[model samples]
Target: MLSLFSLAHAMEMAAASSIRTSPRASFLTSSTLKCGPNFISKTSIPANLMEKGHKRASLFSIRSQQSEPKDGSVILPPTSDSEANAVTIKDWEIGRMQDEIVSSQGIRIRRRPPTGPPLHYVGPFEFRLQNEGNTPRNILEEIVWHKHTEVSKLKERRPLIALKRALENAPPVRDFIGALKASHLRTGVPALIAEVKKASPSRGVLREDFDPVQIAQAYEKGGAACLSVLTDEKYFQGSFENLEAIRNAGVKCPLLCKEFIIEAWQIYYARAKGADAILLIAAILPDLDIKYMSKICKMLGLTTLVEVHNEEEMDRVLGIDGIQLIGINNRDLESFKVDISNTKKLLDSEHRQAIHDRDIIVVGESGLFTPDDISYVQEAGVKAVLVGESIVKQSDPTKGIAGLFGKDISV
Candidate 1:
């Protein structure tokens, strides 16, 4: 059986590009395909096409080679045992090939499992597979895989062309970076990007009575320069509705749509929902994707806050051009571990010098609690901080900010 991960990957790729089938291969028509949570399509493939030597030029470059009869129904030839096995083997190859490209860029997380270990036959007996490719290796990988399915379905409903039309009524863009800069100089402290998050996979529910707009207003009143709204509904328990609601609520602080962004389509979606800035995590995105997505944000008048967790990710972001804002996250997305030193470690003398030369603003993210924590990252060269949990959970989040920075920052 082809795993859901494989199906999602194949369908997403097919939907993304025009189908071009080779004349020699067997073709599955759209009638044979069904769409639903429980629906699965039983399609046939020729054994020869699954051979090792056959390959595509790129990850998205998929080629189909089957022809359909005039009646729209084609007879599938009976498959031998070896041929039946070849089907899954080919699926495994495609996933492995795509993963190899990501791993080559120093990324530890695999986009998807290289489709579990191939079936092993030992003297006419098959060994049971212990671990499967459908299982995610870490929290971050799991989130990315889930996002793949979520985005695919969302794109289907609101296609890119439709989303473009909605942009006509999207609220005007705000100066996200300017707000942070002004707050930093005004307060002589790290400008706050207070996160309006309700829950997390690691931290569970942080606020039982979560009012996104109320928290946003409190943060702004407490002197936050920008607001980071968690827009992921599955794991974060946040939604784009909250983003739209907050923006429509008349909050003056610029909004950052904090999402696990994997596609350029998401950029347009965020802008259409009233986001003034968007986050791009260097850990999940490769260099090419970061560059491409950053350009898209620029065109949409949205600031890109490229986040880095380690020195390697920091170095990769530094190599990219036209990046004005960089966020150093102290938490490890994979392990869900928090360490304040991660901020200080990545912004070393060498990287700090490069950032200074390029005029990139570093924002310290996560694992921040007190005045000492803010001061530590400030000393490490972060001009701003993206903080959550500590403030949002307090009875009065406005007073919480005063405790965080050791004084009232409200002007």
Candidate 2:
């Protein structure tokens, strides 16, 4: 058996070799590191493993000769020099990759850096400098950053395995797309996906007496083909509990889990909690993630409402296969600006022909209040509409739906 010192030396040389051969980018200097007995010191990480398209950089496995623990639970390896170098490099690569990706697609919103911000030292003090890499540029970016941390902890508590088992007792998946089509045909206008939202970052607390199940039942009674329940607890003041509660209350409207989905694990979690559909924003997720997540939704018998804010995002989602439902969110999530004309702009663009060809159902979302606003988007080619504040704030949410459409659409 090799001594600890010799083993560390060998590993350091191997790591250095890997870094030198990498082609994407290298941000580490060749230097040996020493650590305590419980720790492993590494010099560098492989470059090829840190490619632009590779998302597994932050999830690399650590190989150590430490003895196994008495408990069967997985052991978390102690932090090492190589891990620190890898994390810093991962942050840098993610930022660079996002720049390239966004340039091609014009996505201004940046993903939260894979690793947290780097630390700067000033003599005896340490400071974390704020930049695009560490700081969130917009509300949407900030929410995503918090979500990355939130989902990590949620996964630890109720892993994918547990979520799968829960699905055995989950409510049957409802036909979200079919409901929209049926409602549109029945109502002679865009079908409503009434939102069960209590609050939003842009507009605080829409309803003080918020009862998710109550709101859901009212919306269904008012002829909403589907319902969108915000599951983001931080920014939206919504939760999975609300979703489960509404579904268990026997509301027939297909429940859409309105969440900033960053991981595939969230898709399963939503299904297990009684969601018939889930929202996937094109601004935050790459094309690969969208495709993968959409497939998972299909397998779980869940519908995906892929949301886009601009022509670039609309174009990106159009290229992907198996996309049946697309949402044109009039509100620019980055700027928190609402423009009802965004829907018309995208539909009138070159994408309209392609969207028609694919038989894609486009849903106009946000900034829609009056019947004229509803008419504008319907003429712009949306088969559905997702409205929240205009309807949810009324003394009777059922009556609010009539005011929005200028007539009662209930059955």
Candidate 3:
């Protein structure tokens, strides 16, 4: 029988050949790795076949082995927690393929890199320089990455258990979905979800004299069905404290915690902070995450507004179950370009049919300014509209709502 070294060398040769045939964006270097006994699959080559006096063949990674897959993906026997955290030889090579798949679908947001443990050898640690793919191409991606890092730090300060206990004493959630429907019935037009905006990355300092509580009260008086409170402090110049303040001020309108929710922890946190509902951007989350997080929100008695900017994102949200509110964003998160037509484009006959058949509520968001703008989006197929800039910029946001609808529906 050929020796293990010869067998391994032959495998590496074959793997390298396969990798070369693919596109260059894969960024895979040639693998001519030397032999370790475990490099070969235990099933493919009998364990007894390994000659004596070699490192007992454990997959050190298919770094340079004939035993690995032709594509150079290292498939080790399910490792312990420690090994799981350790960065193996071909970790990045294999992961590069996964990154390519996520990026191929026009999703420029990269997954956080490997977290190899600081004290390796027994625990799982992801190998991240902490900024692997963090250099975002656009404003949306930058905000998402920043939020991911921000949430990770926040979790340490207030773990989920602590947040859960906070929820115990927290006020009960209002009927956020019900409020929107009630307003629509009261008024012949779409329900208004007025935003409490202080600032945005795209539009800096919406109101220099910003009072979250005051703004919330104004929206309520102006006939807002619900209020969207920007809780992201850094980018949006908002805070969870603002949400808590609005709730404490006895503003009767149901509150939507508008933040970049990257983790499930934030949902519990928002609920604890008196959020009646939460916003889930489909662009920032995968299908599975949206599904899982929506379930968590349901458990917490918090409604979710699943936001989508394009047809692809809308399709992914549609594929999910238990999504009650779908917000079609006129502003493309990736490009930061606002087009009210985006609402019409995404809600084609097929999408509208599915939404109607399911009795789902479609919310038109962003770039809505005039009566014509409101009517245009309403005609496109939305039961609700989330207005921020046009209304928030007004001297009296109460009048802003009246101007938005062209009449005082509050009475």
Candidate with the greatest TM-score versus the true structure: 1
lDDT of 3 at 86: 21
Per-model lDDT: 0.78, 0.78, 0.74
State the lDDT at 265 in candidate 3.
86
The residue-by-residue lDDT of candidate 2 on 152-268, one tens digit each, is 899999998999999999999999999999999999999999999999999999999999998999999999999999999999999999999999999999999999998889999
RMSD of each: 8.7, 9.8, 12.7
Residue 200 in candidate 2, Cα distance off native in Å: 0.7
Q: What is the TM-score of each candidate against the true structure?
A: 0.80, 0.78, 0.74
lDDT of 1 by residue, 1-411 (tens): 333334446654553232233344443222121111111122333333322212321121111323333334343433333333344434555556556656777887765544332122223221222223446889999998889779989999999999999999999999999999999999999999999999999999999999999999999999999999999999999999999999999999999999999888899999999999999998888777788788889999999999999988888888888999999988998998999999889988999999999999999999999999999999999999999999999999999999999999997
- Model 2: lDDT equals 0.78
Spell out the clash pairs found in candidate 2: none
Model 3 spans with C-alpha error above 4 angstroms? 1-101, 104-106, 113-134
Report lDDT (Cα) of residue 385, candidate 1: 97
Q: Tell me which of candidates 2 and 3 scores higher on TM-score.
A: 2
